[model samples]
Structures are given as structure tokens and as C-alpha cells.
Target: MRRDVTAIVRRRGAGHDGGRPAPRRHRAHGPAIAHSGVAHLLLAVALARGLAWPAVASQAEAASLAFPAAADARVEEERPEANFGADPGLRTDGGGDPEVRSYLRFDVGGVAGRVSRATLRLYVAAGGETADGPQVYRAGNDWREADVTWNDQPAPSGAIVDDAGAIAEEGWLELDVTRVVDGNGVYTFALFPQSGDGANFHAREADYPPQLVVATGDDRGGGPLVSTPTPPPGSGGDGAAIRASVETTPVRHGDDAADDAAVWIHPTDPGRSAIVGTDKLGGLAIYDLAGEELAYYADSTPNNVDLRYNFPVGGERIALVVTSDTDTDSLRAYQVDPATRELDDVTVRPIDVGIGVAGLCMYVSPVSGRYFAFVGDSSGTVQQWELFDDGTGKVDAAKVRTLSVGSTTEGCVADDGTGDLYVAEEDVGIWRYGAEPEAGGERTEVDAVGGGHLTADVEGLAIYYGGDGGGYLLASSQGSDEFVVYERRGGNAYVTTFSVTAGAVDGVSHTDGLDVTNAALGVAFPNGLFVAQDDRNGDDNQNFKLVPWDDIARAASPPLAVDTGWDPRRVGG
Candidate 1:
């Protein structure tokens, strides 16, 4: 069924001459109604195979589904980095005055059976004309709609799926794309023009949004196809989709390599701050604000890392970065070099915590001005250690206390100003405990998996500090691909939730760890920055994504606070 060249079909004008029934169109903003015949066939197959039909589809469309573009945008060469994701129309030109290219992404994970047919349907805008319509090609799924530019746009990776001839009139253009789409997962496509006249089409925001008609292989009865609308936000999360502004270099290793990240705010130059991350399969890496690697060390398998500023080490106050070295069931420490923006190993000796290190976070006590590290394991054992300068300018630690979270756990963070520690129990929820060593093992549940605020396997936990004790607690709801936000003070009431969709960079998914700061980091992040470890990075290895805190604040339903008064340097003061 692989056709090197497929003719593009228009729903209007000459398209009617083919004698095939014209597909029904859904004009309003809602789920698409399916063709009756195709729906019957699909339902028969699903029932015969004992498969669970998705509730999103109606009775008439059970077999076939219509998906609107999950993310779409056009990039113009003239304005390389300018984003046109919100534009009503998308443009594509074949090396004209200013070459323009368009990209579209579709998440087909909901499609149950083998895909027999998939059609990319687009509506030509009224004022545009094309001597030769754009050609469709396969593309990498790593680019985001909100921020994709000509410079960062993914190049077409496969042969033309279809090419339209002359299109003098405006109408619906359908391109058959069954070859590249097989089963459930994210798929990206690129549209490139074949002539100077180029063309314009309605974007996802327009009334005539782009659509994909998917027919499962079980549908033997061929009939006209209709589209299904993209599903709305889940009940557990607010449907806010924020795009990442920057992404760190992909880890050298693949398959669950990048595990966690810690933001290091520069003492004098905030914009020059660095991100220290872990490659669980290999080692640790440091990256600058531009997402370029600054340094990397393959000394140990560090699972999680956290840092605290102003540590009395080596006879001078310095910033310290620490990690749970899972390779040796010990802790590893590094001294931050502001001048080089790199790390220097400073672990005095191998301090074993007696359990396999699964997660780790640093704490600077506001009451005693002491620094501590909480090291935890998959078996739920957590050990607290007090780190101090070992008179010889190296770092050493003394075991202080231990606790049991009662389940498989990882991802933890400590609020230096409030003396509070938050831990995530993978299949369970988040728990809060006093960070001070003497506070003991007593803990309280913050939110649970079925509580509507979180889903199973809660991964990373981060605190966004605001002015006068006003802030928010962010947790990575891994199972749902969303981030749940809660009020920082009071009972930590649920506030809102969001997902990192594609933008200037690719969106984040299955995030393992994340960190945030309210300290303004120059013009790029005047309010602050939020960094998350992205589990999937297209064809490359996993990486970290950076989102401006203000973007999240403004994108929320009631809007989050855009506070930038807190200085990370004064955490324990």
C-alpha cells in the first residue's frame, strides 16, 4: 500500500467527480461525529476482539476518529526565531522571497488497533493561491508549535507523502498519509511548497482547523470518513499548555538516562546561572542558560542532585552541589566555580547511606544555619546527613536520622526558608515532613493519586518562592503528563495544573524531576525560570526543558503570582 506519489484530493469542486461519498464535516467546536457505516464496522471489530472502546468517541464514530492538530505552526526564514503559533493561518513557500515552512503534530496513542488509513485534511485560506500545492513529508516529533522558528524547525526526514498539483480555487485538501503512521505514538509532518506562489491554510486556532481522519485496520467496510476532535483537558488537571523556551543538550546516553536537574543561580550574574543534571546511566552534566553543555563528568551514576548557596567549605563560603551516587550507595559533592561555571569534586570520603540511593535533595536549615542532605531509596528508607567542611577544605557528612515513606519513592525537595521537606512516593502521592533532623519521621499527606489533584507515580517536587511566604508547590504528575500546582502556604491547597507543550523547543513529558526559582534571571526570565527533566527528546537522548516562570503564571486560569523579590542566595539567612 506504499505509494511513492499520492494525488491530493479536494472535498469541493473537482473532488466530487471521483463518485466517492463526500465526507461529512463538523463545523462547531466539539467532538467530531463519525460516518455511520465506518462506525458500525469498527464497533463490530472491537467487540469481536474484546477491546475497550474509548469513551471520547460517540456511537456513530466508534471505529474511526478525527484528531485536530495537537500542535501546529509555520516558520519564515526572514524572521528566523519569531513564533507564529498563534497565527490564524499557516504559510509555506518553496524558496521564494522568504521561504516559509509549516509543521503539524498528532498524538495517536489513543488509536487502539492497526491504522489502515489516515488522511491529513487542510482547508486552503480564501485569499491564497498556489501554482503547485505544498508537498507533505515525514518529520521529527521534537519541535513545539508555540516557539518553532525557521532556525530550529525540523527538516523533512522522508520522501514526499503526497504532492498536490495546481490549486487555483480555495477548498479542502486531503493528503493520504498511511505509510508513515502505523500505531499509537506522536507523529510529526512537514509541509514544503513546490512553487514560488506558495500557499496559505487555516491554522488550528481557526474555525476550519486542520484535521486527521484515522480508520483502523479492522474496518473492512470502506465508507466516507469524518474527523474526531481532540479530547479536552483531563479532570485531574487544568488544560493549560505552556511551551518550553529552551532545552538542554540531549544526554549522551539513551533510554531513561536523564533523571533530575538542579538550577544554580549565578551569585552576581543571574543570566549566567547553570543547570546541573544527572544521567543515571552515566554521570553528571552542567549546562548554561542557552542549553549548551558547560561540563560533564562520567565518574558516577548520580540519580538526583540539589544545591544550597553559601556553604562554609574550604575556608571560604561557597555554593555546594550534592547528589545521591547510586552506583556506590554513597553521596557525592562538588564545589561550584562561578568563574568557570563548572563543578570541582570535593567529597572528603565515601559516606555510605546504607541503602541504594534513589533520590536526593539538599536542605539549609533556617533555624540552625546548618546544611543537610536527604537520601532516600526505592524501599522507602530515607537518611538525613549533616554536611560540613572537614577542616582540610573538603566536605564530609555525619548521619543524623532516618524515616520510612512506606512505598517506592524518589524525587524530594526542601524549602530552606520554611524548614519543610516534600517527598514523592511513585505510585502514591506527595508527603510533607519537617526538614530539621530532630523533627523525626512524622509526615502528612499533601495530595493523593485519585484525589483529582494528582495521578499515580508522582515524580519531581519543586517549590516556587514568592514574596512574604506566598508561593506554590509543583509536582510532576508523570502518569498523566501534567504538573500539579498547589498553594505554598496554608494546607497546600490545590491551585492549578499545566503541561509543557511544544513551543520554541519541544514540550516535556514523563518528567522525572524539576526545579524553580523566583529570582529574576536577567531579561530572558525577568520573573524567574522553571526547569524540568524531559524523559523523551525525539530522536535524540533525553534532556531538560526550561520555561519562564512568568509564562506559567500568566497562562494559569486565575493566573499565578509573578513574584521576583526572593533571592536564592539568601536561602538560609
Candidate 2:
């Protein structure tokens, strides 16, 4: 269960007793928490009117009786704390008076259970002075609140209080404070409790006698709601779990570049994997898991890179294919070394059918044991390729069939389990073609029941199969900063939609490429990892991000994951 803070406020009503305008309300949700260390000082003006100090304390005890004893409460024997100060240079026009400012810091001990709401009670020891009212502020590091309060009927405008009323005790103000989860700075308030009625009372000077009291509430068992689901098993596991790492290109690189990535798991050794990433410019870089650059392939212009096992020519395994947006549209192949971890040679082959290629999808067919590559081109077409297995075990590219669809095709993928090809169009939703995509063969569009919200710029697409014989179609709603996951029912149709925003990752402003794999690239590799390219991190080139699959699997909400770190190098050094 995930619980969000619904509201944070200091006071009620449009203006203070003095007719000052009220403060604006702040409402936020999700993971982004705001924290400022600044303390807010709230002055309760009504309490200072000719009231004795001892009487103020008694009133506070009475008001506290309204609430029942907290189930998780434990009393701490520590003495109450206090701080006092004034700055002559502070001006009211600046929204704060330095001379009337006060600071109070104290910790509540014997915290027995999770705390949902905390209220502070302060008492004034002297009759001539008043306290600044309380305002709730947040901290960045820890979700703690530094609530400030003051004394007055209908606390001052812009003040953080629930409701302003006459102070029950003389010269003392009772403040009610709330906490901001993300705010990290102190909240300041101006303390100027009045000593007489509204028309006759004059504000006391900073040197006037003043006393402070602080009491905190411990309603851990019953208060506002605070809920968080338990994390999955072995997620933040001990040593030996392959922890995810991140790297960003030097800031000098072009802006918003890193868009997509392709990972090649060594067939013979699952522990090793190689990756090729698109810089969005014409450059292609290869990297290992350790954040080291192994090779750099510059095409002057490249679109995407994918790995596929073409025909095994001579008892060898061939698994490299790159798609380029060059004028002579073609799919390029390279010989990959499983042990040496290198792309030894490169080969470029034009599409056998005249449909120009735009994007590429490569995957090994689990049923056929043969490598299949699908090409999506600007011609609104998808072409299939049967990689020839040269005797030397090298893959020779040959045209299989071409399937045409709506204008401007963007992404294509072959489901290894079903041999069905999933294609995404720029305008329409996702379309599915038969195992063999051919000329004049119209592919069927998946039912748009829950797929209607699929954004206009749905550039990235991936599939996740569930054990219940159902699966998911994860589509990147690039323009919306949301990743929409749809449930795939029978007939390869999507039925429902859910979304998740990846945690703040540089360069991922607009997602372009996405991929997911359950096979372990190494002993520490997560069972499933979702990779996306960040277009907002670097200039001209894009960076990549790795999100844990388990997080996505368990999440009932959106599947957004945070980028753990940043590294720019291509291979592990």
C-alpha cells in the first residue's frame, strides 16, 4: 500500500484578525518530497492579553484532553527545551521581523510505533510576551516536520494554523503544526502576541518578558494514514546480488541524447553480456556491465542496434545486426565474439524487398532455433529476414517477407514464444502481423479497449508475460513522461492500462527505446531488467537506464524506477 500526503496547511480562513491576506495552500503527491531547513515562526496574538503564565499552561493541558491517549505512546522524562533571539535589522516589509524571531529544537524519545501525525503544544511563561504561531515545513533528507505556531484569534494571514481563536491563557499562544514530507528547510514566523484588545493592544517589544513551552503528540496507533508496501524478497539482497549501476556521458556531450540500448547475453556463458547504445547522433557505442567502453562504431548516421542469431554457417553462433537511417536503407550485420567479447567484422545488406528500412528488431526464435530480424521502415512497412547460417557459423542476411501497415512505422518486435510480430505506428495503436509478415498481407490491429490512451509519441514497446497465461504490453508515452503498461488478453489484444514514471534519470526526458529480458547476463543480474534511453541527459547523444524487473512485477501502480547512478563510459574498465 502506498499512501500520499493529501494536504498541508497552517491556518483556516481568508485573512487574519488584522485583515492580512491568507497564505496559499501547497498540495503535492508522488515520490518527490520538498524539504527546506528554514523554521516558520507563528505568533498567537490573542493569548498575550493580560493573561498570567501559569494559567496558560493549564489551558494547554485542557485542550490536550480532547484527544485519547495514543496506543503507541511512551513518556520521555527529558526537560523541555528553549531558544530566544531577535535581530534589529530584520524588517516587516521583508515578510519577517528579525527582532521577534525565536528558534526551538527538541527531540521526542520513546517512539514506540510509526507516527502518522505530530502536534506541538507551546506555553508562554510570562504575561507581557506572545509566541509566534506554528507553520509546518518539510526536510529533504528525512520526512520530518518543523511545525511553528503563534497565539491569536484566527492566527495571522499567511500563517500555518488549523483555525485561529482566542488564546485560552494570558500572554501565551497555542500553535498547531503539520509536517511536509519533502521540505528540508526551517520555517520562520514573526512572534508578536498583543497584550490588549484588537483596537487598544500594542505589540510588545522583543525585550519584553517571554517564556516558551513545547509538547509533541504521539498518535502513532491512530491518526492520519501512512502506508508503504513491503519490498520484494532478495531485492536489496546482501553481497553477491548484481546491484544495478548507472553512468552518464560527460555533461559536455550533446543535450538529451541517450535514447535506446540493446544487450547481448553471451550464449555460452550467461554471466557475460555486451551492449550497444544509440547516441541519437550517428554514433554507436558498445559497453560491458562494469561501465567500461569496449568499442565505438560510428556510422555518421545510425538509428538502432539489435542482436539476432542468423543461420549458423560453420558450427558457429552469429548474433549482431544494426539498423541505420542511411539513404541506401539496409540492415547491417557483424560477427560477434562470445569469448573475446568483440564485434570482429561488419556487413551491410540491403532489404531484398524494395521497402526501405526504418527500425530493427532482432531476437532468437525459441521455437525455430533460428535467428529472426524484423525491419520497420518509413515506408510504413515491416520486413522479415532469415539470417543465413554460413558454414563458418556466420549469419548472412536474406529477405524473408515484407508486411505493409499505416504510414510511418516506428518500432517492431518478434515474440520469441509465439512467433508473432508486434509493430507500433506513429498515429495508430500497436498492430500484430502473422508469424510470416508478407506483401499485401494486412496485419490485425489489437483491440483498442484499454489501448486508447496510448499517447501520440509511443516510441518504445516491450512485452512481459505473466504466469497466468496473460501478459503485458509496456508502451512509452514519451510526450507524457509516463510509461503505460497494458494487459494483453487472448488474440494478442491489450485490455487494461497502467502507468509508472521512472525516478529522476538524466537524459530520459523523452523515452525513445526500451527492452526487457529475464535471462541472467551475470550471476548478479536481476531476473528481469528494463532498459530505456534518456534523451534529456546529454546533447546529441542519449544515455541508458536499467530498472529492476521485480519492482515492475510487484508494483500495482506505475512501473517507474529510479536511476541509481550515472556513468558515461561504454565498457567496464
lDDT of 1 by residue, 154-184 (tens): 8775334556555543456666565456567
Off by over 4 Å in 2: 1-259, 268-271, 290-292, 309-311, 325-327, 346-353, 363-368, 390-394, 437-442, 447-451, 465-470, 492-504, 521-525, 538-540, 557-573
Clashing pairs in 1: 66-227, 66-228, 144-502, 144-503, 147-503, 147-504, 426-457
Tens digit of per-residue lDDT, candidate 2, span 1-573: 111101111212453333322211211111111111110111223123322111111222211111111110001111112111121111111022211222222223322222222333332212212122222221112111122211211122221222212332222232333221101222222223122211001112221112222211222112111112323464331111111234434212476545556767666665467666766555666766543567776653456667654335465435655554444566666667778777754553343435565577765555556566777777687777776654444446777777777677777666655566778786677777655433246667763314575666667777664443355667766665556555544665433343333221232456777776655444224344567666654334446665545434434322222222221111111
In model 2, which range of ten residues has the least summed lDDT? 68-77
247: Cα error in model 2, Å: 4.4
- Candidate 1 stretches with Cα past 4 Å from truth are 1-237
Q: Tell me, by lDDT, which candidate is best.
A: 1
What TM-score would you give candidate 1 relative to the actual structure? 0.63
